[model samples]
Target: MKQLNILLTAVALLLFTQEQAHSQIKLSDIFKKVTDRQSSSATSAGAPTTSEIGLGIKEALQLGVSAGADRLSVKDGFLGNLAVKILMPPEAQKVEKTLRGIGLNSLCDNVITSLNRAAEDAAKEAKPIFISAIKQMTLTDATNILLGKTDAATEYFKRVTSAQLTEKFSPIVTTSLNKVNATKYYSDLTTQYNRLPLVKPVNTNLTAYVTQKAIDGLFIEVAKEELKIRGNINARSSTLLQKVFGYADKKKS
Candidate 1:
């Protein structure tokens, strides 16, 4: 089964060698495998190849990361996109309600805005981490991911990279939160809420909140980009992408 997968991948990869700019492949198609066997490459399997089949996986990751990062890490990246918008953390919901009920609507709004801005600021630092994680992919990882369900890569990243990303992002989120006065806004809101009659004091970690939110939003975009490649032919963006993903599509049908 593993040899067969490699043979099929290698044969499809030939389309990329004909000056057709086959380097641009989709991550979903690259990971469109359904086995949990040992990882094998086209060359090792003697199927014929210019590069390791894992290269295709890596390339797809690059595209997904670049697109995901580009779509985010910008003005209103998290704030404007409802799909991935950063909002008041669950623990702070009552604080928001209390603040809003107390007629501090502007304060509530500012705090939410600042949280999102911090997310955007911290998002800029994600590409290098994402790329590093991509480099860690093994042939087994590639094959398993390709054969797994859609968003499997996203789940893999979330599983493996989430902790590292949070560690890396926390300080950046802290800095960004401070830069955006999210800390001050949150502090002011919390301080005021705590003083209210019988209102519980809140001491949430603002940086941790934004870090996780940023990571979540980042993956949402990555999944979207992956789905685009999987389902939309126009979204494939390159001959290699078309050929590799077209194979997946044909097999599925």
Candidate 2:
């Protein structure tokens, strides 16, 4: 009985010593592995440098801008898409209603069509403007966008380029309105409305109106594209895009 007790104590001590040494070795290895990962994670884990993120965002913006331009620059781009279709300004609503009530529905329709046509024409020039804004993006901008809301990039564009867009788009909208005889139709509507009893004259700047609406519609499309790229795994084209947006995807999951 004594021998049995002695044997058990020795075995227990041996196991305790072995376990303590094994745990020390394992803890050291684990810490070393963690340190190595921290050191290499910049180039590892599909390391996406800031510059790579910048380029990826730029590429995505370029594609988004080009796609938006192609879709909007065509006939019925705005007129056909009720989601983005431009309606008469607030001041023109009375004019439109009065004209339509007088059996001048065709006249009103022509004015509406011409307005949308002018917007579509002005939209052709938006691609370059959007590209310019994308090119102006810096590493900081890219990083923030990658970590921001789906529409964050689009909002950045409004902050940086709205003034420039307004300046460039106003003239084109004016030219396009004239080219499509939108002015003639608008004038006819307003002249008739002014002749109506108890109606105030509308001196709305159609050029500025269309220009602002066109810019708004352009941003809507851009936001949609940005959302699609951010949310859709298959939409990520480049490796950098995969890395940057993949991080987003993981967080979302």
Candidate 3:
């Protein structure tokens, strides 16, 4: 009888211990889940939403485009800026060289100046095109742009708006070229070059060349503006910009 009573007590003690351990494990799991949920909620609360990301990216792009267009549209914008100044086409380098060789320096200078003038004129019309592209940005695009490389937004603009910009800029450039007498001067330069003894005739498309250069210059400016906004806190002008880009800054870090 004593041995049986001892065995029963031992069994009861073992079961009680097991039950306590099981309860502890269950409580531990519940606490961990609650903590996890709280942490996740905190993270989400600190992060920007999908809509805010899209709006922030759009705002940044618009500001960039406007600044870029405004800088290039002013007088001496392209002419004074060596970075974007339109010059003689590669195929016409020989022509310019030949023209300048024979006391035609004045005419060569005129051609270079007029080419930049046309580009400057065409740059004035880029803001609207860029704004339209910004308006069309999707949530996927916004997220990618925010996390992508320094020039990702600029690349996006180039990819989406290049064709439309070309279409819009061609006529404006052509008109500007004529207004500035670039066409006449180029024709005169090429004519003189072609007439030179033993020289191959060259007929480069001035309008097409100038249009592409102008587009490239605008993109360059836009890229700079984008970098400024991403890397500099002060560049975020509005409350929305600050909130959106602040979230981006945190994510990047």
Each model's C-alpha lDDT?
0.81, 0.87, 0.93
The clash count of every prediction, one per candidate, is 5, 0, 0
The top-ranked prediction according to lDDT is 3
Between candidates 1 and 3, which one is better according to lDDT? 3
TM-score each candidate: 0.77, 0.80, 0.80
Task: Give per-residue CA lDDT, model 2, range 1-23, as digits (tens).
Answer: 99999999999999999999999
Name the better of 1 and 2 by lDDT.
2
Each candidate's root-mean-square deviation in Å?
A: 18.0, 7.7, 10.9
**Residue 192 of model 3: what lDDT?**
87
203-243, model 3: which lDDT tens digit per residue?
A: 98888999999999999899999999999999999988898
Q: Report the CA-based lDDT of candidate 2 relative to the real structure.
A: 0.87
Backbone clash tally (model 1): 5
Tens digits of per-residue lDDT, candidate 1, 95-173, equal 9987888799999899999999989988888899889988988887876665567887888888888888888889888
Error of 1 at 165 (Å): 0.8
TM-score of candidate 1 on Cα atoms, chains taken together: 0.77
Cα deviation of 216 in candidate 1 (Å)? 0.8
